[model samples]
Target: MPRNSDLTPDKALAVKWINDNVAQLSRDHMTIWNLHEPSWREYKSSAWYVERLRAEGFDVEAGSGEMPTAFAAVWSNGDGPTIGGYAEYDAVPGASQDPVPRRQPRVGVNRHAAGHTDPHSALGMGSFTGFLAAKHVMERHGIKGRLKFFGEPAEKMCGSKPVHAAKGYYNDLDAAISFHPHSFPRLANSCFWDTHSAPYWSRIYTFECDNPETWQNAGAVTGVAHGHSAARAPGAIDAVCLMYTSSKYMKESMLPHHGSWSLNEFILHAGQAAADNIAPGLAQIQYSLRAPTLDMCARVFEVLDRNAEHCAAMTHSKVTANWITRTRAGLANHAMAEVTWRNFEAIGAPQWDEKARSFAREIQASLDIPPMEDPFTPEIQHLTAPWDGEKAFREQLPSWQTNLAADDYVDYTWHAPTVRLYVGRPTLRAPNPGYRYPEWTRHAMGGVPACIDPMWLTAGKVIATTILDLLSDGVSLDKAKSEFRERTGGGIGGTSWIAPLLPADFAPPVHYRWPEYVTTVRGQEWTIPTAAP
Candidate 1:
């Protein structure tokens, strides 16, 4: 058993490394627009990390699957068991912010806010901690085996799905470990199901009306005028209105609560070099649709196409429609979740009270927060049940029959065994006196070298220790796995489970394109775009 003292040196080193490197990491992660674009510089940053690992005597590989920043590093002591540690360093495009907040004089100028309050700078540091801990253990105890670190990019908006599919990254590892920062401290045993709210597809359509007389009459009669009306007298603008009204009916009729659908980006008279005399083109409009299943999504698209064709026929204008992009089916992987929960508990993280856990139940039950569903006095307490893997799996299996009496579609109960945990600085306020602050978070960020540095060191220690426990020979991986499963109420094959509300036969779409680029900025990926102009 490793004590807190066992991780002190590694943690100290990690905190130092992160504090020194955060600015560079933040810059790399926040600059990219798309992960698939070659312009993103995260690829280079990942390579830099790899070189650092090499200096530490680890074997490193880069450019996994054309994704520039995606890489793997390994330290092996003969051929024994293998353990993996993963880290994510992607940024949310719209969430860029400065390290600290600015006051009044700077308020109106879009001062840095909302970027990486969760500070993923800690991930790399944490991973480093794991790496060094393993190094120390191997050196001191003569433990022989392989410890691998994965620099995983683009997790905002669930980028991991594609990474998982493209690289088969997690498929062969004996076990994997990672962590994230959060407001509260508790292990997350339930992972969100990757179920798309509805299959929603989007299309952009442009219409041009060439009839001069009709164009002028329609615009004048409707009491609508364009700024550039004098240069182009084409009836294009009128045609756009006609299309808008036509699509509005279609939208209202198909609307389903939390179902599928949406329409936006209505651009009118957008073409340049078109003055008065009824411009040659009326307008361009973009419409989005969401549905519960692929079939329904397809049906919505067909309706959109038919609506466009009808608009074309009525306006006697050319109409061109094209699909923009389609997201994959939402995910709900019970098997992977089962494995995740087991690993979480085996790590000895604290658990939450069943009564308090009901907050999640409420969210699941409503499928949304309330004020949205206040009219019905549904059983709110039912939402708080702990996730039961066996129950969820049996219910999701193809052989299971739908039970109409139960609210299959309600999503009112815990559905999976996905866990999330937070380790904070010791300086943070404690809920009460009896509870000792974990010292974990506080010490990692505020100590002499700073608490963040040490936290990373501790992370490495935890990863190495956990991996050793899991992969050691005669260690009863199954028993350890079972113990974790039992904490979550059982494996997915058990009987007392409620089926997920998702449609049967749904499969998540697989993206085969390798990431064209990797951003290296600190924080969530979406924050990057917002951070800039």
Candidate 2:
């Protein structure tokens, strides 16, 4: 593995740039965190990045691939390999919390309003920091290459990246880098090895009740037509309920209860009438499926479609299915992984100071557990080898399962040589074996500057160094590309290669009634009211 001493003049400059701009990066992260925008509705968050990237000399195309909250930005130094990196800024609903240790929702919003959990706030700014640092170095040293920075929204649903891939946005890239804050101990401070992420497929089913009056009952020819005299048809609301219930019942049969797989549903909208017996006009339910193989996702989706059909027919409504995203399982690139790992080793892991530890102890004390001298998880402050991380990651999975959870970054693997780098986020040490910390603890730690900055700063350094290395080291870049080609049967269109699940003309489902904050007579708030009932 390469040591820190191996960093060339340009790579050293990149690291120094990031170090100098730490304060600005932190402010950017906090700005996005405060915005707290959700999937498909990252209006402010996306716009902020757009303005920022354009100011940095990138020719940015706003709303790329017809997704309103996605952007593609590029800066080039003549003709050379185009290296791609991206940022995700969308937050999650019901994760709202203040930066304080105790449980307190962010002010001026509902208790359940959107907030950063895995905290894309840091996830995004970390990559953005690295991109800017590398750009600075390239300009100062006259390095030759292209940098592609993408604004990817709605990643919580595993959205956007697949659409970007299908629309040929990533087609020109020679290499790509993906970064995520380590949410699990086994995967902290390492790059993926043999095992990567599984496939994720999401679709929204809309049920519309166009003509509830045309149901199988006739109205009597009475002189006075009483309101109660007519038979009322069950509306979209009933259809959605049936769809939800039926899917829950059939989830067990969707696939064998063996591998690491999941089927989750979210009700995007359930319309209803006030003070009347009229049927609801529209309802929407989204289902996201994650499993080890494309075949597994297909089987599960087939069952869901069958259930939706039955539910729609029973409730006198018509249902339509729209694709949100369909991503292939991850393709491993050991050579790319090695390149990233070497850079990570050189940067070392995040080092939390006494101030960060003091805040952690406050959290433990709030939870009524005795705070130790070192309250953070061991992995957060140390490095782990990719092979070692993979062994620990595979311990809970069946031997046959090649992939674990799901992430949209896997979509980039098929397009070019890609590496998914993991840096440790702040996590508390468990009080006892099998004991889990409260959700608020993680959320609070994420917002605290002292706690979260270490992780993202380390991530920025590692990514900058790696990008600089790939740009200067032809041998390393070629080795990674060779591995990518061998894995995908000669890159992209080989016999064993898998084409994008979405077609080039596939339309993104941004029109769905996704959850978002709204401004009304009551001012800005989540769709749900914040006042006490």
Candidate 3:
């Protein structure tokens, strides 16, 4: 913490203001959660945030990163330093669950539609409320600084931010601050994540089966000795299957499994299935890979590219890899973390009242778990270091490990001083002799305000205070920048720095077949919900 200056009155007022307005904030959070749009298709969700930010007197760029749903909202007061925060609104595909104790899917819709399992509803809420709270304090106190809240959509696909970074969105900002709802032991309600994670590369490889004659009868003709019937050539579907299975077979040989690298395949449907024994003309497969280092990721991609080529050849098709989302490893800054942690200790844990406890017990009892006076752990209401995780990462990899998981928010670390503050959203718990709480129970808790509002309010306090510090104290900002410069050897163009992985001219994969809600004259539904009317 910076030399213990007395708590700024304006900052105190800002925290109070946010606490008083938690009810309104909770309503907004539930609204977004109910939308539950996935990936690049968070149209309603993005528009709602943009409209809310504008109503709070922010200048919003509705579509900033060449992505339709991606946006940035700006508010400033004569600009001493420009600080940034962002919100991720995209839900995951096939994770549908309503906020109920028992097993429940989207009512009158899909049982496997997109839902905010990461509970991004609360994640986006904390960040956005922080933005508003900071705006309130700065405006009231006449604080001289610039602030921006980015409407980052498609985070589930790791989309948008890299495009923003490459296009010079975060260039003028002094620092970027972000927070997430984490369940990792000791990481909850504490503002600490130094040895964070590395880059995750997501790309789509498309295979086109244009020529059928070559595979079936390159040596024979349609009306030749084969009697007008040409032996069938394996099509794009065959090629996709070959590529998928081949990568699975080659995965063990691809990496040494030392640094926690993984690659996953997703087949995309982009063409009509041919009939009359004709070869399929088009098929696509996406691969999202995470690695501790860029070199490791590169080596794995090379093997994948080669496998795609061979798979295409075997099925008489052509393939191309379309780069979608690419993020670099996180750059850690202890100075920023220290400031945020100091605020975390000040705010203490979220106060889970008796009402919340009863609701949690209700969910637990539905699952046949005996309810205790406290089903949820009281420890989560306090601050703790992520000791176990930090130790495991150290033991599993080099002590200098920087990245361990996959997230596009890590992109901010590469550009400027970025800090990730973690807080615990409410999670359902099971006692001894009982199994873990079902995912729906957790989802149920996440949607309820009594459970998640504490997280949102506490996170908002940390964010508001941190931004207040940067605005009120130049020394803190300088310390953060100094750490950033030393870490990057001079920053963005520094000798030891990493550049944006996705090219500036690269195209986003918006045209591909991503899972989205399908609307028709029969009303609305998610992905043509596989349920009877």
Candidate 4:
């Protein structure tokens, strides 16, 4: 393998490459909505990165399977077990953005306040570094093996599943490693890994009610309408609120350890009308439910369905629930984790002191939070301790388990060894910290060219070196996989390291509520405007 010193030089080069190319990269991927499109922004970014890899002597292939942007590039010495490094560069809609000097008018009108905080941008750099490091190791040690870089896109809504189904990307790989940037450095044993890193399922429910004159005639109908008639009325607003409230209650009652439920989008079909006269004809709601295992997720869905049925009966509305997407069970390869832990220990990354550990214990006690009942927690700190497993397992309650129908169940098996790493970043700390939207634009645009570029490059070096170590002298894949599974089992294990807390201070809240409106040009047909123009 290349000497650690030789691998060090590439880190500086990686940063320079990211800085020099970030603007063009950002612009190429820019869209009317600023969210990634699998065929557009994501595909183009993949091509661009692949071209860079080619220039560095890696064998690059663009457009894997039906996915236009998905690609696999390989560098091999002669013949050996293949190791996979993955990257994703998709951005979220309405996330924060970098401000520029010129004010550009809105296009599709959707814009992010903070962009790429999920750390996909860093993935590009990290994967690149991994590939480079693997190449170096093979050359130095004359090892006959292959290093593969998989450029994955559209992970925002778990877009990789379709690609996986069509291309079978993971079927052939011996092992895979990827990382996401968060608010702090965490080891595999941490609770953050356990809670957030598990496989999950998403359910979207749409409730539609047809009541054009219910609100307008509500008062006119008097006492008869207030009770029995009102019960029969299909009130869209009531249905939406009822469903939302019921789901919240259900989630609390379930008290699941590895699952979460939340409501996202709500669309009401009232058209443009005064509040008293506005009788909505339709209401659509999006709900997300996640669990560590598919069976758990399925159980949660059963509860979700029961809750939905109850809401529908109470509100007298028709509801349809659908599974939009599902991710495979998270693989906590014991072998890979131990190697990573050793690396972290050797590097002397921050360790939890006894006082800090005591403080965490006190916090848990104060909250009456049983010791890590659920594998996941929003509190990223205190997630990494070997001894905490028994306590965590003890806290798992029976009520958390829900009965599931045959159709609702899914197996919880992973195809191969996988490890997901998380790194801390600035945007994740405070998404909007009093920075004007315009200022945010400037920060995003300028910051990418300055900070992100170099940071990605540095990330690339670290990841690349790690890959080299694993490929050359690090450890065997089978051994790593066996060890990782033994240690983590089906849980995130423990908690020790905590992510840095968000600053207590709040930014001046931007008070401008999204104005409801519909605009029509000369050639447009006449229509009632939805909001005050």
Candidate 5:
């Protein structure tokens, strides 16, 4: 029998370190909240993380995976088993608000600028605390392991992680831990085991009718070709419209309504020069599809391709589709998930005190709902299993489905044995046991210190302790890896496992007309861009 060192002491130290540094983590979380950058434009937010990681003595790669906003930081202590901790710092575009109980957007910020809705500000900082805390204790105890921290941007777009996966960033990990703010009532204080996320592939299809002359000439209405002005082709605008309506009409039939799959379409660019209207030449439509399997995504894309082609041919235009992101469905390691959950149980769920409750009352009063002495129920503060809460709600979601929502973090599951952890975020108590809270109410609560800090701190403690578990105990790591190989068809490229969906040389959609801030005579600000007057 092999003699093993006690992990109980290391776990204790990691928890203490996280608790001791909660104030610092809170400050960092506030900084990221104020930055509030959206998608590929997270320059300030990304830079701040890089600076902080460098300060902590990790060998920093400023722009890993060819994404400007993404980074990888590595710290090794004589190297036993390598573990990965991931962070997502991107903000959602539509909503921007301050931390006040009332709804108020940030001042001196663009009216259309992004805000932390999933509140990735806390997500990143919370993970940051875990990464640093684990590293701190590992060094003190002479532990042997390598810790890798990755800064993943554009999580809202379901972007970044797939590219990193394709470029082989996660190829060498023994195990990984991923955390997100839990919005679902059922998954609080829980970690995912078997069913994981569905596959997500977002593509942009561009339709170009650069020359109506050809369309007119080809038609030749009277055997005498009509002039460009008189015989105008419907052009890109009609092509886009046809595709949109056609897809909406075909939505139900794309796949059997039996499974949980969704298709969302956005008009990215529609006619560059609408005023001129000499057959408005260019249009772009982005279709983001999510399904439980990649084969399902491919099947849906085939129909979409046919729709774009038919629409383009009808309008005498041509269409081209580009993959904005392609993430495979999640893989699971029961051992790894159990290990993470055990650490979470040791740490306990976030403890919300009177201050957080007081703030919840303020929000309730603002909503004109009578405030309760304790606004949040036990679900918000107590830890529960994935199967513990709201059976009726769980029943509505099909059991065969592992992932109801599409998130790019699922990409990591294929690379290494990973556990997806979810802890509770702030939610309104609601006027009644079943009343729904306003969107802005929950969004505002996410930014409030009292409402969100417990989550950040608790998540930090759990993540750090879990990392230490695998690092110190070879039995824990081997069990995780063994289960991973069994599930992933012998790891990465096993019989059933496939390579990353995107090709290695595939280009990042950096040039796409993503939303961002523009500098003008009034200095710098962010908003959805507008056409020139």
Candidate 6:
């Protein structure tokens, strides 16, 4: 715990405001958890944030960058540095769970309806609580600076940040703070050091059999009768199946299998209906690649394109590819990491009281395992140094690979000095060696206020303090900027700097058939129908 005398008056005010508003954070988190909007369609969640920020005296632009679910909110206290942070409200598909100890889907929704997996509900509220608390302190102290909070949806697809960066939404910031729930054990309660996130590139392939009538060996009969009687072309469904298998075979050869690279595909539209003689005309599949470098991503993409081409040719379909997102690898700023780490130490790691432990024990008992007295993992209640986390993060990687995993936050690091902060959310300890807990344990813990508030509330104080420090402590901010310039060869658009991978005029992939809730004659349900036809 930080002593009251250790903090300056402004910092104290920021901390106190966050402590007082804990109920508000809890309310907002539960509301978003219940909303559970998925990627590319966070309509209600986005509007809620926009309205709340506007009510809090910020100028908010809803539907930012031609993406209907994105927004930018800015509040300024006269002329000073501009600090940036964001909130992600988008949930993952197939993770729906109620805030209970056992397996139960959220009431009144499809069992497969989207749910807050990492519980971005807490992520958004934590950063939001910090931003608002900082704003309150700035107002009370007459501090001079600007605070920018962005409503970033579709993060599960790595969707919105690259678009925002390409369109210049992040260009004006002096620094940025990125926060996440500590989903990994190695990263608990620390800021990222040298090994930041890798690059993620996603693309969709569409195959069409529009010219099946012109296939070589079809009978001489005309359009309608020929389609049913003549030998039919293999068509788009075959193309999609072949593409999927071919890519699976080629994935091993995409790289040397050295670094932590991955290639995964999602079948968006299978294009098959009730069995009829006419061939299925259209199919679409999406490929998402994550690798340590852009060259690796490019090589994987080349093989995918070749597979698509061969599948289309063999199946007598024509294929076209569209980009979903292209993101750059992360560049680290040590100074920014250092600044955030000091603030984290002052705030201390989150403490789980007996109430939280009781919930974990209940979850364990429900899972048929006897619970320990302290059911939570040690890391959740303690802090890890940034350097230590970096070392642990690199355990599986080869010596030369610097970045690991993929996140859109990497885009922000190129724009300004950015720090990725992780505060531990609730996690239960394994009862025996190699025994894994079910997914509901995590989702349940994330939603329960008794279990989850400590993480977000601590995150709130850390972010508020860091924002105030950057606003008032010009020397520290300058050091961070200097490191960013040195790392990027002079900062944004310098000799070694990496620009936004997407073009300014690049269209957002809102038209894609992403999984979302729909209102049918039956009722509101997942695009995947709740009942059999």
| Highest lDDT against the true fold, candidate | 6
lDDT of 4 by residue, 1-533 (tens): 11334333433343334445545544433421133322123544676777877886878777664456667777778867777776677654444344332333223333422245444665565556546654754576576677777776556545443334334454556566665543332332221223224344555566655653443444656555443344235555567777778777666665343333332443423223245443444555655544444566567678778877777666656678755445544434555544443333222222223433333333344334343322122233223442243244335423342311111101111434555544323221112345222333322432233333333443444455455456656455658656544544532222321111112231111111211222366331112221213
Q: Give the per-residue lDDT digits (tens) of candidate 1, residues 1-533.
A: 12334333433333344345555433433332112121123554466567777887888777553455667778887777556665555543223333211111112222232223234445555555555556655655566777777665544323332333333443344444445543222212222233212233555677766554443344444335554442334344555666677767667665454432345544534444354343455567666554445455577667777877777666557778754334333323333333334333333332223322332233233333232222211221112112442245335433422221110111211222222223332123223356453222321222112223333333434444544444443453445344434533553324543333222332322232222222345433322232454
Better of 1 and 2 by TM-score: 2
Worst 10 residues of 5 by lDDT: 1-10
Per-residue lDDT for 1-533 in model 5, tens only?
00113238887888788778777778888888878888888888899989988989999998788889899999999958888877788887768787777877666775566788988988887888888889999999998999999999888778989998999999988889889888667676687766677888898989998887766554545655545336787989899999999999998878878778889988878897646647878899999988987788999999999998999999989899888999988887778888888787777788777888898898888888899987886676777754353353357677766665688888899899998888888776667667887677777877778889988888888888888888876678899999888887788889878689898987778777787777877667665433321
Clashing pairs in 2: none
Go through the candidates in order and give each one's C-alpha lDDT: 0.42, 0.89, 0.80, 0.46, 0.82, 0.90
Evaluated at residue 323, the lDDT of candidate 2 is 87
Clashing pairs in 3: 197-403, 197-404, 198-403
Cα error of candidate 3 at position 26, Å: 0.8
Give me the overall lDDT of model 4.
0.46
- Candidate 5 off by > 4 Å: 1-7, 217-229, 386-394, 529-533
Give the CA lDDT, 0 to 100, for residue 519 in model 2.
Answer: 88
Which wins on TM-score, candidate 4 or candidate 6? 6
Considering TM-score, which of the candidate structures 5 and 6 is the better prediction for this target?
6
**Native-referenced Cα lDDT, model 2:** 0.89
Worst 10-residue lDDT window for candidate 4 reads: 403-412
Tens digits of per-residue lDDT for model 2, 405-482:
899999899999999999999999998999998898889988889999988888888888888888887777899999
lDDT of 6 at 306: 90
Ranking by lDDT: 6, 2, 5, 3, 4, 1
Candidate 2 stretches greater than 4 Å from native: 1-4, 221-223
The sequence of per-residue lDDT tens digits that candidate 6 reaches over residues 325-347 is: 99999889888889888888888
> What ranges in model 3 sit over 4 Å off?
1-6, 218-229, 274-276, 385-400, 433-435, 530-533
